[model samples]
Target chain A: EAGVAQSPRYKIIEKRQSVAFWCNPISGHATLYWYQQILGQGPKLLIQFQNNGVVDDSQLPKDRFSAERLKGVDSTLKIQPAKLEDSAVYLCASSLGSRGGSPQPQHFGDGTRLSIL
Target chain B: AQSVAQPEDQVNVAEGNPLTVKCTYSVSGNPYLFWYVQYPNRGLQFLLKYITGDNLVKGSYGFEAEFNKSQTSFHLKKPSALVSDSALYFCAVRDGATGGFKTIFGAGTRPFVKA
Candidate 1:
């Protein structure tokens, strides 16, 4: 099986600009997640999707960050009016889906390294 | 709120020596614990997980973790470490009772193995 795929291995832009990162999950996966990893810290959940419907987004910066997983397959995360603090690695992951309340391990893509100037 | 913690920022050991990375977690319900490895400029790779069976779980790359319920810890251990095993290790946890099934990761521990 192919691993999760992400585009634009690297990105650089000035503050206030807009950027988007794309991700393709593994085949048959029904759960997708977006995470932001800052320097010297762990990856924080930005959003989570079960199929096409959102399961969680409480940690997402709705004012600036937006994400969607259309058709329950691929996902895209957008950051508008990016701030200097927004510079970090954006990771996308997928899992085999939760069954009977048991969570499965997630498969991750290489991730997009975004830099804000 | 559920959380995970890796108390050590880094661990150093010589090749052929045993290595251990400490991890502790807190959650309201039964914990689903996991260990992941991340190389430089790469995404996190799943190494092992402890859902419910034995307290000691074996994983990839000759790694194993002991789940101590009383201690609320899941520490990764590998005997006869190799230089290639040196990398950043992350411990994660999820509360089984939580509806979202969200996973929380620790700060991560970097292990440096020298030959």
Candidate 2:
């Protein structure tokens, strides 16, 4: 199966500008996740989608960060008025879905490297 | 909430030498653990996981991890390091008891294999 696909491998924007990242999960994957990884830090979960509906977004900065996974296939993560601290890599990952009370390991994409100028 | 920790920022070992990257986790109940590797400019790849059954779980690329419940640690180990194995390793944990099923990742540890 093809791995998760993300667009615009690199992006650079001025502070306060808005940007959006796209992600297409592997075919048949029902669980999708968006993560933000800063330099010298591990990836941090921004949102999770179990099918088309959201299962978790507690860590997402609702004021500036928003994500939508319509039809449970493709997702878009948008950062409005991006901040300097938002400079990081945006990663997309998918899993085979949680079954029998167990969650599977996620397969990740190369990710979008974003730079705030 | 579940969490993972990688104490070392980086580990250096010579090629063909044994390598071990330390990881520790915290969870309210049974912990679901995972090990992932990330190459430069690439996404994280799953190397292995520990759900249950055994304290030692072997994974891809000749890697294995030992889950020590008493120590609250699940450390990644490789008998012989290779230059290709040099990359960032991340440890993750999920608390099954928490219906949310959210996974928390630790700060990554970079492994450098000197040839």
Candidate 3:
């Protein structure tokens, strides 16, 4: 089976600029996640979606970050007025697990590395 | 709040020797622990997970992790490491107590396997 897909392997923008990243999860996956990983750090969960509905976004920075998983197949994460701190790798992952069910291992896509100037 | 810790910033081991990477986690309930590996400029790949049943769980690429409830640790181990095993390893945890399945990841540990 094909793995999760993400576009624009790299991106660079000036501070206060806007940027967007796209992701297509593995087929038949019910759960999709977006994460941000800084240099020398582990990936941090930014948002999670179950099917077409959001499951969690507690850690997301609403002021600049917003994401949507419409139809539950693909997802898009947008950063408006990007800050220098937003420079990091944005990752997308999918899993077969659902809420209240046994957890499954996640498949990931080669993330988009963003640099803010 | 659920959290994960990778105490070592890096670990070095010689080829054909055993290697261990330490991980510890804190969660509200029975924790779901996971191990993942990442190469340069690549996404994280799942290695293994410990949910229930066994304390010792085997994962991909000849890797295994032991879950110790008392110490709240899930350490990754490989017998007779290969130079190909060198990469950044991450420890993650998801709190089973909550209905939401938000995962928390640790600050990764880079392992160098010298040949």
Where is model 3 more than 4 Å wrong at Cα?
none
Q: Provide TM-scores for the models.
A: 0.98, 0.98, 0.97
On DockQ, the stronger of 1 and 2 is 2
DockQ metric, candidate 1:
0.85
Which 10 successive residues of model 3 chain B have the least lDDT summed?
A: B95-104
User: Per-residue lDDT tens digits of candidate 1, residues B13-56?
Assistant: 99999999999999998999999999999999999999998999
lDDT of 3 by residue, B2-98 (tens): 8899999999999999999999999989999999999999999999999999999999999999999999999999998999988999999989898
Clashes of each: 0, 0, 0
Q: Candidate 1 chain A, which ten residues in sequence have the lowest lDDT sum?
A: A96-105
The pairs that clash in candidate 3 are none
* CA lDDT, candidate 2, residue A12: 98
Tens digits of lDDT, candidate 2, A1-117: 788999989999999999999999999999999999999899999999989999899999999999999898999999999999999999999998777777799999999999999
RMSD of every candidate to native, in Å, equals 0.8, 0.8, 1.2
True contacts kept of each: 0.72, 0.86, 0.86
With candidate 3 superimposed using the best TM-score fit, by how many Å does residue A78's alpha carbon deviate from the native?
0.6
